[model samples]
Target: MFKLIIMCLKSRSNKSGVRCYQNRPSSISRSDGRRSRFGFVGGDIGDQNMWRSRPRQIHINRFPPSSKVDLRAALPKAVQGSKGEWAVDEGPTLRWGIAPVSLMADDFAAALSVLPEQHHRIVSCVAAYQSHALAFAERHQVENVYTSFEDLAKCPNVDVVYISPLNPQHSELCHLMLNHDKHVLCEKPLCMTEEQVTKLLEKARARGLFLMEGMWPRCVPAYHYLRHQILRNRLGELQNVRCSLGLPVSQGRLGLYGGVTSDFGVYGMQLALWVFREVPRSLKVSGRVNSEHVDIAADIELCFTRGKRAFIEVSAERKLSNQAIIQGKNGTIKMNNYWCPTRLITEEVDFEFPLPGGDQVPPTHYHNRLGMCYEAEEVRNCILKGSNESDDFSHNESLLLANLMDTIHAELGVGEIADRKQIPDLQRQIEKVQDIVEDPEELASETCRVVQDVSSGTLETKQQEEEAPPRSKAIDAP
Candidate 1:
């Protein structure tokens, strides 16, 4: 049986804004699949129409939306150079530069910090506020280190930059790099607003430069495997998506970062968008706010057409399951540590009442930049091909995600950390897209239509089931 709960806020007089809270639902027993006594009373289950699982089964041969593009096919094969090391056919070998000493930057460099000539060459390093860049460069034996942004930007040989600076500085640095004809792979939550993202995209396009958000999750091997399986349609029509992610944060940073929404919410949002490849028609969000008036926890409900929906929860105070569950008519796919999926569990057989354990499996781990290398490889390919946007993480996808964050920030009453009025064009552009954002029901319907269109065979199966006589039992016991 399918169940849904929508929670929203009502204005309660307070300086911060209205805070919404609902009593937690009682835990339902797994073995019996019985509704708990603490929650709302159960309704009639005798009616087959209300309880029967949808009969749509996506054919395995057809490609689902997840696997529509090949992320690695754009690059040509490596060839022998005068140095006898592998090199691309294009002109001189690509040179890389690292910037701004930060944990994210450190992680990137660590992957490339191996023995010289081991893989790609990152020849330049620069850090603004931290002295560790020199140490990092020395340890890695990098030849040049620039203290000023100007020197790094002006360097003629530096082909690309892996930018993971403070969130607020992303716009300024991205513009600087693009203007200098340098390709960029900026970290996720690229900028605070869609206006900034659009401007950066246009700038990169005009300059003929490669630019991509470092959403490492999209490039990993496990997700690649998941997408491949999804494309084969083993699960049937995706009816629901559930994502939960959380991380413990210092109290001071919690309010400034706007808690889980800005931090882990994007992962949830990204997963949902990837599944449907459409904007949600409508969304309802309610969450707790810290004393600083920033959201620390949020429960988000996204409605898509054809009665499809997603429930996503994000929190900053404690660790979460950090998993994403994609449920279809026939089976379910569970991704552990979904943000960086090292493991994936798929249950392809008929989904029984007490979901069978045999169908579920444990996650298998892989070692590839902890999976960050996949995104790095994508950046390298984009740079080599002279492409402005990635096939996997497209410019439109970035804009949609930015706009979605804007909506969340405004709704949650944690406006931009930096004022938008400083950039009048951005403010105006953001205002323009607000009206076009789909209502929840509209988004749902649009997604459902896409699902139906792609899974035509599944629709036929549903039709066949409708013509057949009803089954005697609601759910058969194992």
Candidate 2:
């Protein structure tokens, strides 16, 4: 049964803001004497429309519309109601509060639309601008709209917050929501640095709140099938994983803090980690950076135990095969659009899992993005079970991925976008080197000398310098 209980705030003469509290619903026991995880008993799991025949209920408590209210004091504790508090019977619907209307936020809403109404609902939203908040509220049918994170954090009815801002804003916003005792599911690349991700994990653990990186692939059915195959020894001893993802784009990705490795390569790296389930023994990376010192293309090799390895190539300059192949001693498994896979091929069988919302265009920016619903369902399940982290994409996995990204960025000499002062210094150094090798013959000789030193692991010999051609001729020679 679905029920809605909304507690609206009414201004009182002396109190700064209105405060309300409602008791949480107890789990309902089935005829077999087992309690349903989500407090409701329903038909078979495969019947998607079974909930439509059952009753539906929604409970939303609106935050005060005043700036003078002390949010910390107005908010309720994470635990259930205390003595003497009014109790309201409600369903197990988890209230969601989204922030900063963006493409990802819309995608999340679309995903929620497909889920059972008794399990999840969007009750509140926070936007940077009033107009955006109004528009998002109108479009999503959300009644409570706030413009600041502080206000969103003060909302007592919001059970969890789905943060989908820019890449850099992820850490700060996640901290805010967790501090407010709200569960969080932030987008991938949870933080800009490994240390930041560590801190967030620590905070989530200390607060006893659920936290997960929105690496949607981990929650999809195809990935589950692949994991099953590995666990059952269907692929034998895994040896190699080769994946490539790339796109031909210029402006948005080539700017500061915009790198193809972080934006596109993370999917491949996560997949490799999922297969190997351990840290690589040693790794090597080579990538080309644009004039802004941001990586545009990269070739990464991760060497693991027993000579197993993973090769990944990611680029923003052009398109690649966009496929992942896992080679084992017994057979190979290939995945198309491995990042958000819908098709899987093994020697024994070919599996296809099409995305939800058939024939309806998804409200997402990327391909096969409707798969995001799987992750949303994962979050709902975890929160309902009172878990602090998901086994599919755990804290340790996120930490490993963050550390890997840090290593790749450091090797590529890509600095944080916030560090603007280093750009001029780097440009000046380049100019100084150019000034020293102004003559074409001198430049060509220096290049040849460096190449010889690198190739032979020794100083340049006279024969190497003698073989060097002029810069113009060398350019045409290649």
Candidate 3:
């Protein structure tokens, strides 16, 4: 299995509209053919303008326009798209290796199970086998299973390492596999921080080790068709793109605000930043207060350097709803279960796009693994060609996500940083990062009358449920 690991739009000062695209010049640049020779830097489609793709810098104003445009400072040296001529190689008759690294194993394991059915491509299963592992082996007629990373990593003959550790562990494990001269398909957020991400990019370049983030959204032919339609302008001028998926804190942890925004909101937030192809400039969060006056739910609003904008609402207090809605000036596209639910709705320019492109799925049938199978395939393909890193989910991309998350925490509220043991390890880092929490009274007074400090002089639990949604991680992508 490939492993990897945000707020809905909280509105503040609803009266004053935010200019989502401000300082950055240019919107989407036109490119039919005759693209730039150096697609590496200012040449590719994602380049051109900040509004059209992810912002290159953490702080937009800190650097000049030139510095901002060439965001490839830390990308892998061996730059190559999952380009053709390198179409995914046919699987080896006898499967080479298998490694499961994420909490959810259904997708990766399922992909492995099919190897025997189709081509006998996968041979061994390693890294903490779960209940499904045995059934998969039996069904696929394979016989090897490992319950430890040690055994998997130590397999000298193992051709590929299937990695799916949590967000924090992805970087080191990926590096370990690559260093072992084994190909690797680790999950998304492949590196937790920009520093670690940078390291992976360099290592991949040096070793020609295959690496790709687990983002299944790209793998589906349906999405490719969607992009094609959008590119053709058959969809018309896209006005707003909004997608959200959230769950209550898996461990019921408390975050800066009572609603626990830290753990799960990153996906939504990252999506907000990514789809717009811009960095979040000013982030806003608005929540209602209970008797204790703690923030329960927030409608988080992120204004990008470009005008493209997104809002997410996340709350533990509500039933689960994961949806994606994209509205164009002339049409709309909506999905029911973004995390692999089968139902979706697409209405455009007096026509509702059918299931071939969009539809709906009942919740009862939603049993797929955390949809990341494509990322794993990408890794295998890259390794087969002796290439390292991938066009999608480059090391820089993961690092940017981490840095962006860290930045968002700093802007919205101070995230109390603690390791798994809840021991503070980076007081200095925290201090350097998150905004200095002023007196609670200051925020209470500043936001809304509905919010107030407690009589006991402590922030309360549970804020108003705003629209801001949490980031969905692998589970969020559909």
Candidate 4:
């Protein structure tokens, strides 16, 4: 009789704090130290006595259940095959990795809930904390849990990594993943600056690796239908887009990225850009900022080519309609919950694109999060087709949105809270350098060089100070 040996690799805590065992098969060794291919020991192939004398360390469970049996139960029916399945020859499966399981965790989970298991799998996860990684792993049935982003990037099994860390960390993480030759799908805003966005895009292109901003709105079925209609001039002489998105998030939650602009405003900006398909001619921006230099609200007016324009309002301190209206000479297209839209309305028709229903819905903080699966599907398709970016949310579009955010932030004078925190340190360093370098011309040159190097992350002011010659002074005589 063939015997199966089960080994408990580890017991990890799930999201609910329940400990679960991760079991796998282990090979058994014979008394003479020879390995047994079939996990059996002893000299005879079918000796019952030899099988009984097998190493006690090996727990033989003759009818051991498969580890993946309960995996489907943890996911919704959408991923469990309630929806249509992919064909057997669809393509190679894409193994996915996710990092820093904090913000957008629900959205990722929701997307995975709807993605077909055969085509994609959440194989690895990385979190800043080991406990968080373990919990996410147990909850998602992910096979690997890494506490470092670098480890996730280095994982050979992970073909793609979805980065959803804080806004400021997006660029650095993207560079790390891209350098490792792993495809990246980052959540918006892709970066705090247009320059950063440009560098990331260039790196991705040069490396021939896929990179995309997880702008799920662009992948929504309703948005696709709306874009097709506008392109066909069904709306007639596109005039303007008016969009507003707001939620009463606390000041503490805004963190260093500041207020609604980077957090919520990018949605409206991208929507207008998607509609116009061109950069704006000029911008008129107005907003409210708190004492902490965080932008609490913003209202922007974008002037596009041919006298077309878009107006957007976003708020982090208060709640607003969160709806969008696109008006043209002939008719109007209105979207409900425009950011992650499921419904669109026009004069003659009301269109609804509902989420794929299942007995269990994945836990998510945002509304209509299951709709994110569309974007996930798009990423898979793009990767399979050997494309680096999605046509719906191309790199150029992301750059445009980043530039618009940079302009809006500059206009409001509420730069990223993280950047603002470094202002005093930079100013102090400049003053110190000025004291050390007496000549104005030399001072100016040195300051410019150091600042430029610092901005590029190639040098540090402290190191420069240490390397500078000691200040010379004439000794006073009495």
lDDT for residue 164 in candidate 2, whole number 0-100: 79
> Across residues 1-478, which tens digit of lDDT does each residue of candidate 1 receive?
1222222233332222211111122222213242212111111111111011212221111111112222122211111112333222333445777766555555566444321233356778788644677876876667778887767888877888888765667889889988888898887778867667768888888888899887777765455445544544557776999988666666676544445676668888888866654445566788877767677888888776566788999877766666678888977776655676544454321110110011121111221232455576667667766777775677767776776676566567765433232111111111111111213222212211111132223322322221121121211000
Off by over 4 Å in 1: 1-92, 113-119, 255-258, 348-369, 416-478
> TM-score for model 1?
0.64
Q: Write the per-residue lDDT of candidate 2 for residues 229-279, one digit (tens) a residue.
A: 564456788899999876676645355335777777888888987777555
lDDT of 4 at 300: 91
TM-score of 2: 0.67
Model 3 TM-score, 2 decimals = 0.57
Q: Rate the local accuracy (lDDT) of all candidates.
A: 0.55, 0.64, 0.42, 0.63
Clash pairs detected, candidate 2:
1-55, 2-55, 2-56, 2-57, 3-56, 3-57, 3-58, 4-58
Global Cα lDDT for candidate 2 = 0.64
Which ten residues in a row are the worst by lDDT in model 3?
Answer: 59-68
Sorted on lDDT, best first, the list reads: 2, 4, 1, 3
Writing each residue's lDDT as its tens digit, candidate 3 over 244-280 gives: 5445432323322223343335546644443443444
RMSD of each: 19.1, 26.1, 19.4, 29.3
Q: Please identify which of the two predictions, 2 or 3, would achieve the higher lDDT against the true structure.
A: 2
Best by TM-score: 4
Query: Residue by residue across 304-408, what tens digits does model 4's lDDT show?
Result: 667888999887766666678899998887775787765566655455454553435654555666667777777888999899987768786676576567667
For each candidate in turn, the TM-score is: 0.64, 0.67, 0.57, 0.68
Residue 468's C-alpha lDDT in candidate 2? 22
